[model samples]
Target: MTPTVSGSRLKSTVAALAADRFAGRRVGTPGGRAAGRWLAGQLRAIGASVTTDEFPVAGVRELYRTPEFAWSAGSTHRRGVHRRNFAEHLVSADLPAPRTGELAVADSDEWRAKWVLAPDLGVAARARFEGAAGLLVPRGTDAEGWMPKMIAGPPVGALPVIAVRTGLHDEMARAGSGTVTASMPLRTVEVIGSNVHGVLREPAAGSPGVLLTAHFDGVGDDPQQRLPAAADNASGVAVVLEAARLLAPLLPDHVGLAASLLDGEEAGARGAAHHAPNVRSGTYVLNVDGAAQLGDGAAVEAGGPAHDLLAALDQTGRETGVPLRAGAMPSDNRRYAAAGLPAIGIGMGMPGYQTPAETADRVETATLVAATRLVVATVLRLAVHSRGLIALPHKDELQREG
Candidate 1:
């Protein structure tokens, strides 16, 4: 279940993190880390047991490394080829003496030698990545790679090699058509990072748990630039922090409310996925993200056993006159739902999402306060009143998918 909180207090909290100091809260960036720390602090102040759970992830290379390779015709291709001392590790290889060098354009076997070079990186071309030596990629050539588009790093899989300018390879070819050694020192490994938490223990015996969740990572504009996730999530983190302070003590023991500010929502759900193993059953999750702006607010409804909770929220909004609407999928709500827990997302709407315009123009302080109050009230009621499994109608979309 959820807990009851003061609206005024939550609004003030949201404003503080949205300030410039938080620096847009982009995930994995300094500003984003700072915001996460700030969120943990707020929860701790409310007397919750805060724990930052760190997980490891693979970090791709910042620059591509290509080494020159040559062979003396009929010298018999080298048995094994691999990049060493590169930024990441060599996980697996699909071909030996992988294709990467000047090769007779006509032979299929020659394609393997050419494979060492990063090709145009089309879907069909990458299929050959495993068979090549060093990829003979054209320098200054703008070609896609075989991997998801990432803002910070290189493609995650395959062996190592560098793409060089055709001129450079041509020069090498002229030097001696013999055997040229090709290699790239690439490394791949999991690095440790964390998600901090603050917990306000409910009175010893009330009900199941209610988690007020938010992800602190920000992926901002500027492919090379860090995301200043101010509105993307710093605002939401701030609100969750403040909510914890006012409502922690009031929560009954049977109804525990955890102010769970998450991490790594940016790098493909790393943090949430890590924490999933430990979450208790029968929990209710109210996730907040991209809600910093104060425009006409929105409330995302959880399809199961949480509809009455929405009604209470509607009542609170009507009473407070804060403009709160209904929205679709947001953040951590998806994770909880997948775990079979009742969950919903609530926030302020951003117009041009994923851009600077997505940020909050105003705090819409009253509306935020009203929304928090509503969630808290509903949580308490569900914790105390629902006798059996109280399943609400799943939202239209969730039902259709089911």
Candidate 2:
């Protein structure tokens, strides 16, 4: 029997997870911890036995306040507004103190000890600005006039890199050259992130289980701005929670179902990496990353020993009237695949990815329902198929039949 998912429930969950109170749900922050606790409560309400796994996350940078950038043009001071006129590069190094120096173009040799203004900061430009005091690189805006936010991955170099708007760059160019003052104060600290793991049934020896997973963390909010990453991941978690509610009562006694709401996925899938080792071998994992919008149905990426899993997904989609297409999603699914588990990554759509414009209202409830139905159908189909395979004859019996 196909379990009915409530669209209203999905919308409410998305709203709760993406609310301003959650503080963008960034891992290692107070708001992030609050979001995790809220999600754990939701899981318990859905009748799943829940536990949390904690992992250490280091080098997380939070903007203490809006960064300030100003310059002198013929005795008139010009300032750039944070997020509007300028933004910070995630990999930029923290300045010991406010830097004040004459602005120079990247081509000028004097820029080595001055604030260099560059059109873009590619690898070559970054290399050239190695010895410079700092860089003012212009970043292109999207159609919505919002600057794309970036996550600090690995440390690029020692130089501080700030992304200014192209208009600001033009203004500085028109001024010829002037003394520029830029201040970016960031708080770098380490904290522990938690992953909520809930199971409907415990697995028996040599029994294969099904895993449904999603990351609940988003990019932390700016000091003065709200970045509710609803579509990027909150929507996904909402759908997964709905599926867990529907599957708990319907799953067979021999079939095991587990859901992992992970953290630190925005920080390079750190939570998934930590949880992968504890996954039982031969588990089939379905990881949902985005589920608010649909673009030609759901996008699915399969890896590891996923032949059976892929077939079940296709059949389930056909039976459930959900569309499925092949797509690559380099998310937490890859972590499970790397651990030699059959894994598939699913994404419906990401309307406003990693930006301040992302809001809970933008998440479509119908898309969430569709995603939930697809996941439930796939799990049921796989559970039956796996049981059949386990019941198949041994090699000695097959040889006798031959």
Candidate 3:
């Protein structure tokens, strides 16, 4: 009989991950560690031997306090709201106290503690300044006017960088020169991340085996707001768990399958980075990044030597009536691909993305069912391929070759 995933179980799992107690499951936090243990327990319940690999992650951005920013251009003065009119940037320098400086368009001038109006400071952009109080870069908001959150990016502490909404930035630009006061309570810290691996079954001799991966960490809750992170990745993890629950007992006895619930993804996929090198190059890896809102099709990105695995997924998708399209998924799957493993990343849709508006209610049950079914079917197909590709050589053919 074909295995089927329980949609109710998947939904409950998503809710558990998005619950306020997990505090958005940021790596190294109590909430994050608890989440890892909880997932390990779930795997144990599914009759899998679970183990954890600990890895160190550095330069994780933490917003200790909401920033205070106000500016004046001769006659007009405005105070901006956090995540609405302005938000923190990853490259911001630590500035806890209030800082006041004159605003000048970022250029080849000696800034000398003046705040500059610059959008992005690449290596080329950074070379143009020496000492600037901070930067006010124009940033776009989501359709709902919420600035998405990020816990990782390029290095910080070069200078305080703040992202301002386009309208406010344009106003500051039209004024030509302005005075500004801002405070950044943001800091970067080092933390340890743990990856949970569950062994569902062992591969038969010569089988390449199959691995399922998903990041369970979110960007973490805002200091004051609750960012459920139901879609960004909780949905993906839920799908993997449900797929594992359904596929373990039904897979061919010789076929090997395992699930990797990763961490530090919000801070740059450190969990996968650490886990990838230990995996063999020929292993087939399938990573689910998002499965909350499936639109017309699911996005699929193949990396490394993934032709066979991708083909299997494509065939399975067709048979299951889940559309698949080529697209980019910059998630944990890329790390596995980098290690020369056959890896593919899949994403359906993320309704609210990384903003506080990302609630559990928006995740679609149909999408979860479709995603789980797709994963289960693809694993079964790959198991068949494993058996076919690694069969014993015919005695006559072997003798003739010899």
Q: How many steric overlaps are in each model, in order?
A: 61, 0, 1
Candidate 2 residues lying further than 4 Å off, grouped into runs, are: 71-78, 96-98, 119-131, 170-176, 388-402
Task: Write down the TM-score for model 3.
Answer: 0.91
What clash pairs does model 2 have? none
Candidate 3 per-residue lDDT, tens place, 1-402, comes to 334467788888989999999998999898899999999999999988999999999999998887889998877989988888899988888889889988878662667778888756653245335667878888999999989999998877577888899999998887878789999889999999999999988788776688999999999887787788899889999989988887787676777889999999998899999999998658899999999998999999999999888998899888777899999999999999999999999999998999888888999888988888888778777776666533321112211000
- TM-scores for all candidates? 0.58, 0.89, 0.91
Tens digit of per-residue lDDT, candidate 2, span 1-402: 334678888889899988989989889889999999999999899888999999998877767777878888788677877776778876677764678888887667566667888776654355454567788888877766677665546665466778888877888887778988887766566778999998878766667798999999998798888899899899999989988887777666677888999999988798999999889988999999999888688889999899999998898788767788998898999999999999999999988788887888889877888888788878877777655432322112211000
TM-score of 2: 0.89
Number of the top-ranking candidate, with TM-score as the measure: 3
What is the Cα-based lDDT of residue 80 in candidate 3? 89
lDDT of each: 0.52, 0.82, 0.86
What lDDT score goes with residue 165 in model 2? 86
Global CA lDDT computed for model 2 = 0.82
Q: Tens digits of per-residue lDDT for model 1 on 137-233?
A: 3433222211111223435445443444454545434443334355443333344446887667743443577778877765433322222345556
